[model samples]
Target chain A: MREDFQDELTRVNRTLVTMAKAVREAMRQASSALLTSDHTMAQQVTARDAEIDVLYRVVEDRVYDLVARQQPVAGELRKVLTALQVAADLERMGDLSVHVARAALRRHPAPAVVPELADLFREMSTVADGLAAKIVSALADQDAVLAAQLDRDDDAMDHLHRELFSVMLSPRWPLGVEAAIDGALLGRYYERYADHAVNVGHFVVFLASGKDD
Target chain B: MREDFQDELTRVNRTLVTMAKAVREAMRQASSALLTSDHTMAQQVTARDAEIDVLYRVVEDRVYDLVARQQPVAGELRKVLTALQVAADLERMGDLSVHVARAALRRHPAPAVVPELADLFREMSTVADGLAAKIVSALADQDAVLAAQLDRDDDAMDHLHRELFSVMLSPRWPLGVEAAIDGALLGRYYERYADHAVNVGHFVVFLASGKDD
Candidate 1:
């Protein structure tokens, strides 16, 4: 029974890693859509979000099932609960990606990002992509060290987020209020996506260390 | 043993209700600070956020302890899990309130919200307060009917959120880009607070009905 339970746990972990990968790809595509104003890619990212939600549900049900069947205690139980949290953070990351895509769609036929802010958005996207990749590796290997580093990596995203606001509010900013609002909100989406990734990393650290610190 | 477990669950539910009340109060104060630019009130709201975070950690730890000690299964296990989720949502609501307060603090001496949008912000605050109240009652009573009503109630917040953007983007808008950005981000924070409240309501419905839908 113990061995069977471990097998199921392993399968659940694999699903989490797969969900992370899907979220990473979603954000990457959503960023491209926003920068290039590619309506099709933006729509694709929004549509594919359902798949990530489905994966989240899968993880949730399996964790509950494991709890009911095996009554896992102590460390094993913490591992299961952490899996649930990691999946939830990934699910939210997926939603944040959709928000970026929808922002692109909202300004369809026109560029969502202005030329002045394009480089900043590109940098934010790069930081977001790197954070998502780290989340994948942290979950797949249960590497607490890698997970701990996501916090520092997320700082880059935050820095870019502040820069986005500064640039939009600059006197030289030639864009109208509409573009400024779009830039502010889009920067928020990427920043939040990175925050959620860091949250997942913390859960991975807890799973590895069996301590909530 | 079963009765003892029931008593503990009741205590956890009460903690959740208390946490909800605290979050509601935080948003109320935060809104007042934003509209009035009352720096002291804003500081108080930010300072007290740590208390909400403490309550959230309490809920998390207690739920884990209950799971380990009792190994609750089936419906009871689901109840425990739902409690964890409800606490998490409430904790996030507290953070959203801080976001509003910080917006106010960032522009101290000058109102965070311009006079043009004051009425609209007041309305958003009212809706947010209403949502938080519903969350409290829903958790306290485990009233699925009341919980289900939150979705429709949230539409008011959504409408206000859209109106916020329209007001900022209007050709006649008198504010500069900084105020527009502030308005946009503040609106997003309030909208997300409403969304999290709705999420908690869904969890309450699940707890009462034994169905995820």
Candidate 2:
């Protein structure tokens, strides 16, 4: 029975990892859609959010069942509860991707931000995607070290976010006020996405340390 | 032993209710500060957030201990977990109040927005304060009906947030670009606070209904 419970728990983790991967892909696709003003890809990412939502609900139900039936002790209970919270965060991340896609759709055929700003966004997306991947791996392997490294990666995203804001605030960009607002919001979304990934890494660290910090 | 566990859980609930009340009061103080441009009150609210944080951590530790040692089942586990999550939401609400206070500080000696916009913010704060109070009571009493009602109250906040944005977007505001950006961010913060309160209500409904939806 214990082995079966572990198997079920592993299955849930696998689902979460897959969900994280999908979110990362969705983000990349949404960014491309934004750069190219591809309405079709933007719509595709928006539509795919339902899959993330469904997975979230499924994982939540399973975690609740595990707690109820297994009466998970100490480390096991922490793992399940963290998984539940991370699932909620991941689902929200998916929603943010949809938000980005919708914004892309709204401004389609418009000129992109200068190549520099575009590069900054691409770099932000790449860091976020890397952080998401590391979180999944950390959880799967219970690697506290890797999780800690992901936490540091979040700092890089923050720095990039601040840099983006500085650019928006600077007089160098002849971008209109509306463009600046959009850029600020986009930078915020990316920074927040990275923050959530760091949150997941913190959960992993807590599980490994057996202490909530 | 079960009775003792129940009693301890009750203590946790009592502390949570107290913490929620404190947070609501802090939010009220912050709004009053904003309305009056009272730096003292704003500072007071900001200072009180640490107390809320400390209380939240204590409640969190106790809840985890209860779950680990008592091994609560079914309804009991649900109740405990709901309390834990609600505590977290309340803490975040407190943080939001601090954000408002900081904003208030930035605009001290005179109201930040124009009179009409300030009134809108005042109204948002009132709804937010009321929503927090209702969520606390709903959780304390296990009143799903009250919780659902609070959920609807969130709509008023959403409307105000949209109106704030519309005001920002309008060409009428002489404050120009900076005001629009500040208004947008402030509106977003309030909307998110209301959303968290609604989330607390959803958790209450979940506890009462035993269903994820």
Candidate 3:
């Protein structure tokens, strides 16, 4: 019975890792859609979000079932609970991607705001991509150090976010009010996406620590 | 041993309920500061945020410990996980309040940013307060239907947010750049707070449904 429970728990973790990967891919594609004006890619990212949503439900169900049946000890329980939180964060990340995709669709062929936003978008993409990779590595290798670094990396994203805001506020920029709104919202979505990735990294740190303290 | 685990879980739930109440009060105080331009009240809200943060960390630790030790089954696990998510959301709500308080502090006597903004602030506070109240009650009563209604209430907040943006964009509003930026950020903070409240309501629904579907 113990071995069977362990197997089930591992399965759930694997599924969560897969969901995280899918969410990361969705974010990257959505960013590409925004940068390259690829509505097709944006559409793809939007459609894939439903898949992450489905996986979220699956993981939640399985983890709860495992907890009920196995009555896992403290360490295992933390793992399952952390997995649930991570799944929700990943799902939110997917939603962020969908938001980006919708924004792209609305601004197809790329708006003039792209010049002001391109650098921030690129830097955000790198940070998001790196954070996603680290999460996967942390889970696979159980490396808490890499997970810890994610928080620091988030600082860079935050700096870029402030810079983006300053640009929006600058009177020198000739972008009209509509373009400014789009840029601001777009910046916000990126910042939020990175924030969620940092949150996932925190979960990984908790899992690696193997104790609440 | 199983009975002891159940008792401990109940204790955790009780504590979470208390923390939620504290967070809701913090939000109310923060909004009051904004609406009434009460700088002292705003400072108090900011000071109290640290307490919310501490409570959040403590609850998180307890939840992690409980899960690892008790190995709760399906419903029990969902309850704990839901509590964890709600804790994060409540903490974020507190952060939003802090943001509002900071904005209040910046404006001092409160800059008149177009007549529409005052109305928008009033509408936002009402909706945000309602959403927070509903979430706390839904969690307390395990009421899914009420939670769903809270989700609908979020739409009104979103509409007000967009309308605020429209006001900023209109040439008629002479509150030029700085006020517009402040107004925009302020609106965003309120919208985000409402969004987090809706998230808590969703968790209440999940707990009630026993299925993530």
Highest-scoring model, DockQ? 1
Off by over 4 Å in 1: none
lDDT-superior candidate, 1 or 2? 1
lDDT string for model 2 (B55-90, tens) is 998887788788888888877787788777788788
How far residue B131's Cα lies from its native spot in candidate 1, in Å, is: 0.7
By lDDT rank, best first, the candidates go 1, 3, 2
Please say which candidate is ahead in DockQ: 1 or 3: 1
The candidate that wins on lDDT is 1
Per-residue lDDT of model 3, residues A63-175, tens digit only: 77887778776567667677888888889999998988898898787652468668877887788788878877876666788888988878988998888878877878666
DockQ of each: 0.85, 0.43, 0.51
For each candidate, what is the lDDT?
Answer: 0.92, 0.80, 0.81
Docking class of 1: high
Candidates 2 and 3 compared by lDDT, better number: 3
Q: Model 1: per-residue lDDT, tens digit, A20-106?
A: 999999999999999999999999999999999999999988999999998888788888988888888899999999999999999
Model 3, docking class: medium
Q: Flag regions of model 3 displaced more than 4 Å.
A: A1-6, A109-112, A211-213, B1-10, B61-71, B106-115, B205-213
In candidate 1 chain A, where is summed lDDT lowest over 10 consecutive residues? Answer: A204-213
Q: How well does chain B match by TM-score in each candidate?
A: 0.97, 0.93, 0.92
